[model samples]
Target: MSLHGLEEYLPSLVQFCLSVLRISLPLSLAAIAGFWSERSGTPQVGLEGFLLLGALAGATLVKLTDSMPMGFALTLMIGAAGGMLFYWLACRIAINAILVGLIFNLLIAGIAPFITKLIFGSTGSTPTLDPALRWQFFPYLWAAGILIVSLILFHRTGFGLLVKFAGLKPEVISSAGFSLSTVQMCSLILCGVISTSGGFILSTYLASCYSPMMSAGRGFMALAALIFARWDLPRTFAMAIAFGFFEAAQIYLQSVNSPLPSQFYQALPYLMTLVVLGLRRQGLSEMA
Candidate 1:
């Protein structure tokens, strides 16, 4: 490539890397949370619900108390509770976990708007907070730190070994006299807490308080990251960054004069996701 062409692309590439970090941090965390549940052989398709609940709770609580830290703390707690509630329904009531998650997403989607209207006396958006309360990058840093720690815990610790055992052979863990419910419940709570952190990051860093559907399709995207990484934490982290870069590139492309439609540029991330996952699946099947 010509040096001039390379120079032209450098800024776009750098911007893409930053955007990728923003998307990837929460995604990697959510995938790690899902990994824990699935590793224990529990179906956890409800991460989206957990994410929505967390976002709503974080934004709403911050608005109500006018305290950012309290809002974040409560959001994490509520998220854990929400996750545990789903686990109880799935494990104890024998409800399908996927269905339970779907129900929660529907319920939250409806209820959040109503609650926002009730609390803020407005529809579609929440009241704006002070600049300090509105958007903060610290949560992103915290999330990145958590992702690193999770990588260590899952790969290097004895507890990690137990989690692997639980997923691969729940019967074995149960026969060994460990309480499967206990482990599953713990995993669900952890998943909730981490996933909720993403919500807090969104509300606090991107916009203060919740906006309607502010999560957009991030919950599903996070799940996609999980699948793309094959439940591997480090790989998930890297892939999350890759997805972020695609998103950034899409934005950059929209600003430039190209033959492609704007809609095509907008669809790039999801398209890339589908393409990558399809290839990964084919590779696995071929090996099989």
Candidate 2:
């Protein structure tokens, strides 16, 4: 195309890129969380719970205190506390970690309404946030910063090596006289912190309020991205962005006139997910 034609396409391209980034923010963070948890040999099926709780806490605190920074600070604290609790239940108590994750998901789903009731005299949702108070692009910057820092840490630090070994060779860590539990706990805490930030964005930026089940399976999608990347951090993040692009396409398709029903457009992202996973599984089987 000529220069003028290219210029005509530039604005649409920019808008599409922004949409993908916005949709991917939460998924990318959650995928990073899964990377941390699973890299340390801890199964993190309860990421949905983390997202839900973070959304609720973020919306609640911001509504009560009217300070975004304070809301975020308190939300991270809550996430850390949640990490500790998960560690105690799944690690210290000697319960199966997967079972613990499942229980955590159910427990949070059941209790969120009561907590909302106590805080806002309502159940299953929080009050709407002010549009002026809501963020536009700052959270994307935060997510990108986190991705960069995590990449640096994973590639350039001993902690990253230790975490990698914690999953691949727990016996090595134990034989080396390092505390495996401590390593796992630290990873989990970071998992919690990062994943909750996704929820914060979901509640405050993506949506106006925290509603019941607001996570909408993005947590599981994030997990899928992690697995699809074979637990590689950079690959996991890239997969998340890919999924985000599919979602953005879905929304864009919905807006344009098409012969297909709206429901098909709504399910486009999920359908793409199944197709991608199926292809991956088939390729793995053939390799085997």
Candidate 3:
């Protein structure tokens, strides 16, 4: 209850919030991407793959073309294409979507290194782009705008209702003369585009080109947020921000020389995930 102590933490809290906001923007968008695909009755487990591909495409293109805008544009297009490919393999070819996504992740992880070696003729990671080509706050602004638009589209629009109907009863939607496959295909493409933006942010803003597995666990984190939010866009955003806050807190804790082990701080988010999932399962059982 001491005002002085509380004031002392205000700056740290604000910095934490800003870091959370940056992290949340990509996560919320990726969750929304998953939301659309799942709401259309197609499970999208390949968001990570799409993200890696997009990041690679954006960074590579920007480096080659020396235009950040061009890189952004290329990233969107390539991401959508990659998504379409996954849909073809999973939905059309009867391959498991999760497996397909995992394959894509491996492929990108390996391909980036191979390409770096081929192009640069060295074992080091891909080189960074010019400073002028880096993406920054603009992508975050765009992500926030997209989140707002996605919320409205998912909740307020006719398309939203159809998507929900498709999710709940795909056969019924099909019986109503709607093409389920088409809806799913569109959803997959959109998911790819959105998830890829996360990659773009990482590559251009955080680093350049894809370093091996640069996506880390963000794709899975986004999936966790989707489940945590129960596919609701607004709730997804809130959960993403909450997760982001923990991530930022870990950094701040390290900076402030917390007595707790660094590994404990690193493990905090995963611990929270386990707790949240357990609670969700319990809630469902009670409802049942």
TM-score per prediction, in order, is 0.86, 0.90, 0.88
Q: Which pairs of residues collide in candidate 1? A: 20-244, 39-167
The whole-model lDDT of each prediction reads 0.73, 0.85, 0.74
Q: Which of 1 and 3 is ahead in TM-score?
A: 3
Ten consecutive residues with minimal summed lDDT in candidate 1?
279-288
Q: Kindly list the per-residue Cα lDDT of model 2 for residues 127-229, writing each as its tens digit.
A: 8988888776689789989999888877789888888888888889989888899998998898889989889998998898999999988888887787777
**Alpha carbon RMSD to native, model 3:** 3.1
lDDT of 2 at 226: 78
Model 3 Cα lDDT, one tens digit per residue, 76-171: 888888778877887789687668878887787778767778876655366777786565579778787878777788789877777878777778
- Candidate 2: regions farther than 4 A off: 1-5, 258-288
What C-alpha lDDT, on a 0 to 100 scale, does residue 112 get in candidate 1?
84
Q: How far is candidate 2 from the true structure (C-alpha RMSD, Å)?
A: 3.1
Residues 54-157, candidate 1: write the lDDT tens digits: 77787778878888888888888898888788778887797977788788788888888898888778885777667866544676678778887777877898
Q: For candidate 3, what is the total of clashing residue pairs? A: 0
